[model samples]
Target chain A: MAKVPVQFTLNGSEKAEFIESGTTLLHALRDKIGDTSPKGGCHQGTCGACSVIIDGELRLSCLTLAETCSGADIKTTAGLAEGGVLHPLQRAFLDAFATQCGFCTPGMIMAAKVLLDRTPNPSREDVVEALSGNICRCTGYEPIVQAVLTAARANSQNAA
Target chain B: MELRRDYFADVRKDGLHEIGQPRPRLDSPGHVTGKTAYFADRNFPGMLHLKMVRSPHHHARIRSIDTSEAEKHPGVVRVLTAKDVPHNVYTILILIQIGPEDETVLADGKVRWKGEAVVAVLAETERAAQEAAAKVKVDYEVLPAVFDMEEALKPGAPLVNEYHGQNYYLYDSGECRKVRFGDVEAGFAKADHILEQSYQSSPIEHAPTETTGCVVAPEGNDRFTCYTNTQAMFFTLDNTSIILQMPGNKLHFVGGTVGGGFGGKVDVIVEPIAILGAKLTGRPVSFIYSREEEMQISSPRAAEKVVIKDGVMKDGRIVARKVTGYTDAGAYSRHSPYGAQKGAGHYPGPYTVPNVWIDTYCVYTNRTPSSAMRGFGVTIGDFALEVQMDKLARLIGMDPLEFRFINAYRDGDMKAHRQPTEGAALIECMQEASRAANWPVAEKYMAMSSYRKGA
Candidate 1:
């Protein structure tokens, strides 16, 4: 098995690694690049625990082949925070007690980040739709939904 | 979520400072930062991936297990079968000295259910391990499998577990957990109306986002450091030590950070074998369940069938209550026996009845073994009891809540099991619930309280 070159801008920094050809972007990021924000809840694309923003598009890292993601800008939950402060969505999730078990938090934050970036002040239904791909078994989804709406409300108020 | 108006908060103690406060969780910082260390997050150098070769047949006697091909597979570290385990047979309840050793780490003689692990293949990579596991051949003689609990209990039916010597796990007193309070027959004879009903529930999977898994690393002092996602860490350590025939001091189990247990991660499923693999290879071993495995192979809450027979008066008073329940324990008795016994204690419901009889049987069937989930013993029982309450209320032309208020268990009231119930609040709780829902209750029902009973 020969390692192939994978070049990507990861979390505002350029990272180059020679990874296995058939390796998933989840494994490449977590196992190779030492960024463990993207969890491998399921190897299948069904569970969005491995969700990452690649080339400005939300993609399931487990379904996306690592070698095919060459020369792409990838963003994960680890990159959500600024220099020292927490992201508004992260703070919202933390405050809302949305991270029970914390397994689904990374993907959920990533997915919500995309939603907030695109749709500021999303409705409760929109927040629910955005996080429909991510599964949080512990929290019955109410807290997570409330967390997203809280962040959205805060963001809209700040803009106003 | 809107905070409900609590009627009892006014009389509550002064020490209750955090009742309705929205507080941050202690793990919030780590969780939001994506740094909470789960079992799978640990990346050990030279860690061997372990995958299982499962049985496709529901009931099959293993004729032979040929692991030669798997062992010879490229990058395959080792292939292990039943013979490799030091003390193969065990039960999770063995720590409490509850049931006999009824299960094996790997199928020793026969696999009682589909997806039973028969062979373990360890390799350099997960893909290689899975491929090598597929290479291992297990020649099995398919046997007749009985899937239903009642069907399995019939005469000449195929036995799911021969160790039990019966389709049902035998309690010390009889074949079932029995609770007899008074003469239900006499009460039924005097009752004005008789109501009988049946209730059954399907097995429920926990389906936690992160599946059951463990990473066992061999330390320098001949000790194994196991990082698991088990909700019960000591259960894992003790069970693993006992299974491996090693002293408990040699194992350092690090856990308690679970990815949504919901009473599902209490089983000591993966740690023992992962520890064995680490011991044999002197390298870290990771045994994780895939989504399919977590759904199918892992034990879920028991599928239960209950028949409730109640003798009721014209005034909605339940004179006699007889409950016959069956716990579909599946292939083996994991916690089903204990769960059945626990279910027995909840017989006749919370209402005080003079005559009550209960018999709950933990029956075995050729399916995945059932264990604990959220509210394992009483949840299903409560469903049947409450539904029966509603039915009895309908028959008597009475409000369900008022009917319950009349028969509600109170302080100094003797329960079905003979224990006097203290601090009973069913009456007040119902009163408050009725008020909160804006359901108009009669003056007498609204005035009822648990403390001032018969006043």
Candidate 2:
């Protein structure tokens, strides 16, 4: 099989990799570029573990083709931290004990990030709706929902 | 979340530390940053992928398996069958000297259930391994299969496991775990009402986000290092050593980081074969179950059925209780035998019944093997027992909470299993619960205490 060459901007840096024709964006990032923050809980899109931001829109990397994202800009959980400083959402998650087992944390954080970007003052129902795609077997999602709500409250207060 | 200070005020020390404060977890930073090292995160150079070829039929006799086409496929490294395994038979409870380990690592002669592994295909990539596994041809003779426990226990039913001559797991010298206390028949004859009801529960899957998986890397010194997401680390290592017929020192297990396991990852399932692939080829081997494979092949909590026949009075006093229970120990006996004994022990629902009789059977059937989950044995048992109590309370036209307080066991009361109760607090718990819910009862019922129990 011929390996197809693809180039894209990842985490504000130019990245290039030669992958197979049907390789998923998940394998392209994790196996080739060596960024493994996005987990692969399920190869299908049902589990939002491999969720990433593509041009400011949340996308499921497991279901997206690498060749189709040749010139796209992508961001993952590895990019959430800047200069050793954690994001407000990450801080809220830590303080609220939202990340248990952590298999679903990355996707959950990305989902929450998108929801906050669109709706700065989201209600509890909005937070729940944003995180409906991700599944966390532990913690029963109470801590996670509270963490998102806490982060939203902090962000809105700063804006005000 | 209000705590009653006066309830245990005498024993409570002043200026207590670390009792009711929120403690931050140390791994929160790694978890929030998505930098925690799970088993699948680590990768080695030139690692081989392992994929399984499973049985399509629930019950079938395997005539032959021809791996010629699979071996010749592109990027295929090796194809392993039951013949490749050194010592195939293993049972998870054998660490505590539980007898007769009968389950095979790979299906040898016959497949008793659907999705039982028949052949393992190793290749350069996961896709190639999956494609190559499909090329391997297997000849099977389909047989009649039984799904339910009661149907399997019937006379002349098709056998699910040949290890036990009968359908039910043998307990000491009886067909079930037996519990006998005071005479239940005599207590029932003197009762004003009899309540007999049957309750059943369906199987529950853990369904953790990360599927069960492992990666084994062979070191230069002839030792293999396994990175797994198993809940029980030492149990997995010891069982892997026994199944591979190797010394424990030759295997270095790296774990204690599980994604999510409500007792689902306790069984040693994906380690042995992945280790064997590494040992044979001198390369790291990764065997991860897909979501579909995890759902269909992995063990779930056993479905149980319990029948509770209680002898009660119009005054909400449960005099006698007899229970007959059956747990569906599907195909192989992984942990259901011990679970049945636990089910038998949790009888009559914490009430102070004078006479109690309990018997629980672990029966085999042709389905996915049932093993551990969160509160496997006792969760469903409690569900049935509490429901029965509510029915009895309704029958006697009394408040369920008041009825429970009337039958609540005291600290000095004797339990049906011949054990004296100690530190009994059912009454206190109910009283606090009523206050929390803002559901008021009569002042007379509110004055009841667990120290002294009566109507």
Candidate 3:
């Protein structure tokens, strides 16, 4: 099979690569663009470990084809921090000890970013519903939930 | 955040530092930033991908395997079978003298369970390896398989493991693990009532977020370095070396950042085959199980059946307890014998049952071989024993907590295995739990202590 040329904006940087016809966006990001943030967990849309933002919408990179992602804007956990300053969610996660093994952290932060962007002050239930698709076997969801709530409060206080 | 000083008023005297202090996990930043180097994170130039050709039947005799089509597949590098493995027979518990080396790195003559790997294909791409693996032709003759523990034990049942020479693993005494303390018949004869019940649990999967895998790079001539997520690094190194018949120094294991082991990664599953692939192809080889394969083929916690019979007095005292249990070890013994022995050791619960008898059988059946998980042996046994206690308490119209308080083991008491108990805190733990739950206990029951009354 001939490789198809794909061009896209990744982490606010225009990137181009040639990919196979059936290559997942996750493969294109990790193998071609050398972005290693999105992990291959289940690779079946259930784990959400390969979560990335496509045009302001949360999408599972394993389920999205690189060909379909051509010319689309993408955001990943790697893009969340700027100039070595951690994002609010990342700081909150650190303070609250939200991660254990850390395999699920990137996707979890990405999921929380989508939720916080849509609703600045989400309730605990709102956070839970947003991250329901993401699975973390380590922390049992307590600290992660608290971290999201803590980040939301900080964000709202900054806005005030 | 204010510290809850009152809750730890009693525990504060331990003079512990960092125990109560909030410390960020050393790996959290790397985890959050997606910079942690897991086994799958590393990529090598000219690395080959490995995929296994697995058996579709639960039990079958492999008459022949034709790898011609797979070898002819584009980009396919090498096809390995059991013949390629230098020392094929391996049982993880062989170090503990608990096995006859029942399992092969790849399927030998017959496959005893579904998803047993028969052929390994190395290719330039994972897709090519998977495609070539699917093309490998295998001729199998279906055989009778036993799926139930009790059915496997009956006379004339088809043998699942010929290594054991029977359906059950034998201890040094040539029977299942047994524990007998006092005369249960006499204890039962003196009892007012007897209660009997059976408890069962299905197998449990660890289901770590990251599946089992390995990446082996040929470092030097006749030397390989394996990057894996196995919980026990040296165990993998030693086991893989034994399987490849190579020196221990030839294989360097790089690991310890396990995503989540929970006892699942203790088995040397992927390293041997990945190392073999690397050796045969003379290229770095990476073998990772898809989520489907992990779910279907990885070792799971054993499904267990426990039957407890207790002779009790009217005052909630269990005089005699008899336990007959079976651990479905599946087709091979990995850690099942040791797990069953742990179950036998945990028999009769943490109580002062004067007369106790326990027989734990490590049974074999046609299922995915069970190895270990969190508290593999004691967890399931405690589940059954505690539930039996609760049922007994309900039958005698006694408060469950009070019943436990009355029967909780005390220091200086001897166990069914003739080991004297030390630091027995069952009574204290129950008291603390009851106090926290606000369940009122009578003055007499509340005064019962784990410390011996006379001492």
Score each candidate by Cα lDDT: 0.89, 0.90, 0.89
Please give the ranking of all candidate structures by DockQ, highest first, separated by commas.
Answer: 2, 3, 1
Which should have the higher DockQ, number 2 or number 3? 2
Candidate 2: misplaced stretches above 4 Å? B12-15, B451-455
Over 4 Å off, model 1: B1-12
Tens-digit lDDT track of model 3 for A68-108? 98889999998888999889999998998898888888899
lDDT of 2 by residue, B60-110 (tens): 999999999999999999888898888888888889877568688888989
TM-score of chain A of each: 0.96, 0.97, 0.97
The estimated TM-scores of all candidates read 0.97, 0.97, 0.97
Write one digit per residue (lDDT tens) for candidate 1, span B88-128.
Answer: 99998889988788998999989999999899999999999
Preferred candidate (TM-score higher): 1 or 3: 1
Error of 1 at A26 (Å): 0.5
TM-score-based ranking, best first? 1, 2, 3
Please compute DockQ, using alpha carbons, for every candidate against the native two-chain complex: 0.80, 0.85, 0.82
Q: Compare the candidates by DockQ and give the number of the best one.
A: 2
The TM-score measured for candidate 2 stands at: 0.97
Candidate 1 TM-score over all chains jointly = 0.97
